[model samples]
Target: MSVAAAWARCDERVVARQTLITFVGLRDPYAHDPHEDGRHKGPILTLLDERSFDRVILLGRPHRADHSERTRQALKELHPKLSVQVIGLELADATHHPEILAKLRVVLARIRRDGPDDEWSVSLISGTPEMHACWVLLAVAGELGAKLLNFRRTVHNGIAGPRFVRELGWGEPLASLRPETLALLSTRRDRWDDVDQQGAAHTPPRHYFSRAILELAVNLSRHLAPLLVKGEPGTQKHLFASLVHQFSNRASGPLLIFNCATVPADLFETVLLGEEGDGGDGKLRQADGGTLVLIKAQELPAPLLARLLKAVDDGHYFRARGRTPVKVNVRLILTTERDFEEEVRLGHLPVEIWRRLRTALITLPPLRERPGDVLRLAKDELERLNRTLPRPKRFSPAALAKLESHRWPSNVSELRRVIEHAVLTAEEPAIQPEDLDFELAVNLANVFTAAVPRLREGFSMMDYLRAMKLELVRGALRKTGGNQSKAARLLGLTPQAVSQILRQTEARE
Candidate 1:
């Protein structure tokens, strides 16, 4: 049935017996002066007149105690049999969005404890935009199971709204959490940007993709689907798996991690599935009501893979060396070092296992593919490593260039190692190019030499020569650890000229 149709058929008799909880905005368009003593026809009053509520709880700022008390008295006078109470909400300013969100969460928690047997509805029309936003977030996050009330110009009973009752519109769990994540990040957006400005200018888009992956993680967490995370080793598949567990509603449950590649092939099955005569629970049994994370899933033997497929498909499996079936519930999160699809096609991995486990798939791109992330991640890692040092350190301009240039073969793990080494060994406050140690060199100079003239319109021979000279200067600075004196010495020019060239480069940037 359509959502509107479902709400339209709501049992009115049942809702009448419940308490009506709502926020009272500081400004009420329809409210009358208290001393004037005319019947107040505000939205809250309108709602009270139409619906038979058992009691009404009005939440607002403590400073508005008089306004709330008058509202409570008016409510009691209109419906003498009705119970009414006024509660003060701390920090009701719209600019304090996080605190307001926290207050809303607290209110919902109290409602959860006190109104389990009562039908509930929340009004979205009475508060500030920020409060409305918080209310919608709560409803969308499935934290507020209350029916939502809104005002419409046209009345359904010639009285108001087939009142826009809210339906949980966020389709996947990830979709719901995406807004919450954005909200959290939104609160501290300026702080993160300041971190970049104070030290190294970070590539902002790099973190955006991480947020996108978090959206996918939220969806994966809702089911018992066998998740297959495919990425190069050290691309953070394991960390992503942990995030999946952290964001999941099952976060309170256990997370059992076992590396398939580390276990002996003969002991793999027994270790994962557990033997009946074992002293304690095996990996599978231990992970019950929680998550089981398998690292290097590509290394599982064919027999063990077959047994895993059976257990996953049937939701029950017989213990090794025993016939008794053991029922289990585990959200399987698997990380693989190889392309899972290609392995299945080559018959290295069983198709049944692949088909069963492919319910949710997340592929993390290698560091080379996401070059923009290099410096941002490097800066963060460097900052973390410098915390224990005698003094915090930073990277030189040339060293930052080299950090961005080198194609990290081991992804973030390699980056962390390099940063740690630089922090510990460098004598200067700023790490120089010579302080970095990585093998892979991507020669942007050669590429720029061949392409700059062709890529730029109306280019001349002199422009090409200037570009070449610029590349040479950069190469010299990189070699000399960003020391202008050394670069000028290598190029047979004054240090002033090299400094001028570097200034021009910064201006263009």
Candidate 2:
């Protein structure tokens, strides 16, 4: 017996209660039996018309030597309100035997274009070879905005009976399947999983990065903009690198990134400049026509820094292993916590390298300078993390406020770690202040304590507020290239309000 038949027999109550039912069949001999008709269609149509079922699916037996077209014709005549899909056994040519997949796609597309309403019942007919066809069908259901119902089969006296009924959609069950299905489900799901499993945490997209960071990315794209983004550990420098890559002309090209601090000094030269060993080219050659993002570039030794600066200026490098000088078409993006100028003055970086970097210099303000961005980043992180985990978790208002009040020394990265940890450890659905780790809470408390004394001593809150407001406004303006409407959206204010603020700040100046 088919899954749909087994479901109808076991949970007749729930089956009779649905408004529409979709009967799914695998190719089998029993599916061709004329007496097997009422299992999916009759009950589903009864419920839908009676406000019990809106949709129903029936799985028909596979078309074999003994199977007749009478079953198909009978089903068509019986369930006119039901949409029938035949999952063909032919895998040799998808183009020729397009009936099953084609009809399925059409049904799904209709669901996508026009959502499920009171008008129709959905049903599917297939054979045994198409057992795995559930993946494609479920995906179609998801595309059409249909919630999936989990119906389990029960066997009584060696006869399969539809007994258990539970409903779950594409997320959980699909996640449990093989990786291939996960890849086809949603683009974001695959990306999130890959990044998470690979231990690669992404920076928030362009929509979430601060206006200052966005502006810096834009400016960097226009020229070899050397930006010193100084924020506590989690400030999202990697995300900023991705944003720059997105904006640059080489957006389609390879984005070669290396964490300078993590790599040893000996490997730095070979990694960045590339070596001939191990059937590979050096980093410079690999990143030749694209961007080379060096995270914590300040950590590199002076000698390596000089060599790097030479490559950036000359656009070419001679590998230590090989003598041939290779001309590289590369863009240099360096992230550092130390002041580059001070480092140069302290003879850490060559003066000539500083000259190459001076043309486009962007200084990223710490998270403390952009409190408004805190909530935005938190929301983005929550949405991203929810995909991988089994349960749903959201931040409470108090939790968000606490996050905003704290000085994010580690920046976005640190915040993500804390939130991920909290989500993993929490017993309830929502993340609260108590869910936060003690160490993080203590650090945040210290920040508040330090700021309180300054505030009490007449630390000019109005001036500080005005300055931050101006910086955000200016950063938005810079990001949008003076487009008032876009800048207004970025600042989360009305266009007129942004204009008014801009005029008021100008007058004050």
Candidate 3:
């Protein structure tokens, strides 16, 4: 081939390579702008000498399209073996960080439609401060796999030129952050608040945790470390697990939930491992590149818990009929109602697993502890239920008063059930106190209050008291599921004492 033909072929290769997403700055189009340091050759012009890009994607305000065009023309005339493209980005205001970030995201999303994020490098030194900050944020968030670059004026021995900085990121600074400080910073970020909404993205969203634990959850989400959430039965542990998933780097991945208490013993292995013997797809595979939440994990046998902890420890698992080990990138989150420490003390939970998870533990506060959350949850639940209704219903002052005054012993779950039932069955448009049917708890004091009206004429005080004691003991035994020690604690007696009382009561019956 002739010299010109060979040169054209080489230029075509350079033009075909995709790279470099940047902005045309306010000072980017000028032939020469003087600074105290030296004569400015424009940011994009300086980048040419520092780095080689196949193409330059220039984003700027609509009025500033001329700047990008000027930069493109000058680069094409000056450099023969380069490719460049100009993208006119319309922004309401360059100084508005949120708007600039949003607009850039739209453009990048479209650009990525043609290719992946790794295809281009974003220039943090281009455009306005908002654009620069957005690029840094996107890089830190792992929104793209593309490398970052910046050109800055530098001097060595009084000789000045633009210096290239490669792969601009938060690595060094983030690594230097103390654990506590990192958690504090994570909590202050609004991402948690953004995902805290429960249903339909309503106002007064439900937070998965209280103040301290929320911070911890946010911090834990930044990495792939195992997480354990503890709470009572109705404390919304599943939603808490969702919070962890949404906040993680794997937010785009699947979130699979496995209920430890609901799965039958025979199916547990298959459900967890897909097919234990045949290499069938399991929950682990289904949840790969995302999160797998084990709900009510305390019900899992100690041996099984050991197996899970081992698998999560190294991100590797073995199916019974598998030829080799299966490796998956999954974030494991376990939600349990049992006080894990007590479970460990009783040998119900494996000591090894407990020791490993203790440092990663976070507890959800019960609804009773958060008095203000009761009304909010009730309203939120009501609104969710009313979505399908022709006319939306609001809480009446009297009904709201009753709800606020009552103690929500079962937490958010119980409130949800009550609100749902009321919405479905209530006759009036406005839910009233009478419309709500609280699941009245059976306690000694409450039982006594209810029994007062049932007393017979001339009922002896001593006999009444004796009968009440027996009833309380039996109730405790029933509530404890015939566990004498648990019943004894409820009745303020020793296990042996409880046994004696049970025997006496049986004989009398």
Candidate 4:
């Protein structure tokens, strides 16, 4: 006997929030099952019409992917506005739950990480029983946070079609899960798990591959203009150079970094441009059709800097003791810590280069300015360290909060050290707040008490107060890599106040 779906109000109603993810089964491509009366509108296409989905993911097994493309094409044709994707995986054994779970977790994690706020649903009508079981587990564990859906095929009032049912009947809470199973779920990859590998943390990417961050700097790459990247010690200038080089059209070519601070200006011509015969083949030729990053470019003498610019503009340079001009197509990316404003005041910087620097500059801010990125970086670092441990380490909420709250004075370099120290020093698998060791920049109370044991007769109160304020401002700026905003925050003052203090100090100087 055939019965009606009972719910007829949704016959034409469409669900607003929709992202449907399901597997491509053997019968998915067929619009109708000829042998079955009610399933005339076959499983997938029929379910799609009955359900609501703006985006669709058709997960296909390696062996059964013959109809994946056809299904995708058909779905696109039917629903022109729908976003469809067919992802082929290597899960050959349809009955193996573990393999299916692992592969599905990776795919789902990627989707979730990319758009954590997007509303999505999982269909259990298409895949094998084992696959359905995995989906249930995922949804129950809160890994999904997805709506559970199933399609019911039946004949109702002489109409044979599919009906989409949403309620799956809630399962027991996570507390009922075994301690070990709960632990496994806790370790599941979250959105922050994929923190950019080559960020301000200075993790180097493989020379052969390009790892571009979603940054303003990425937009400047692939251009032929001279680029200037300026920041304090740990503000990711080196990493930015790598990012630009890898993403550039000359990525296939070599990337050569020459530090001006390490080598003297006398050797800039020979070392960078190279010398002939006994001298050596310079980086200019070596980095032909690639990128050459000059670290601490301000250290180059005025005369050497002029010659370098001429070579860059003319696309050729003379090697020391060589008659022939060495022609090369290399992108110039210069990094520096020198305060260009101060150089401008001193009149040590050339006008054209200074203008170029101002126009094509990439300023990397200190870590304290990026509050949202701090925990993501810290959690990523923690996970990386856990791979080497006997048992995986987890951080308490307090510990994580502590890491997030710290104004990272020394930037990413300091973050790396702190995380490393905590991971190794932590005795238990769970790291507590006390386990974190921060190298604070100032100790005002202690310093004040120690420095001024007693006030001398000639010590003026106003002068003493001014001196204290100056030292505090100077210390905050130093700790925060000359970042006025971070220095102001540290001093419990506004940026304008900090600027006024700095101006007063400069006047005194």
Using TM-score, give the best candidate's number: 1
Judged by lDDT, which candidate is best? 4
lDDT of each: 0.66, 0.55, 0.67, 0.68
How well does model 1 score by local distance difference test?
0.66
Which candidate do you rate higher for TM-score, 2 or 4?
Answer: 4
Q: Report the lDDT tens digits of candidate 2 across residue range 1-509.
A: 99999888887644332333343332221332246453333222222333433333343324332332433444456557544333334334322224545655655554434433333333222322232244334454454334433322332222333323323334443434443332222222111112211112332255456544554565666666444454345566766766666466675466777788677777777777767656357766777667777788778887777777677678777777777787877777777777778878887777777776666666666667778888877787776556546788988888887888877666665676567656655668888987765464335334423443345576887788777677767865765568786566544466888888889888998
- Say what the RMSD of model 1 is: 22.3
Candidate 1 colliding pairs: 155-160
Pairs of residues clashing in candidate 4: none
Instruction: Please give each candidate's TM-score.
Output: 0.51, 0.48, 0.49, 0.48
Cα lDDT tens digits, model 1, 270-334, are: 78888887535578888887778888888888778777766766889988778888998777888
In TM-score terms, candidate 2 sits at 0.48
TM-score for candidate 4, residues paired by index: 0.48
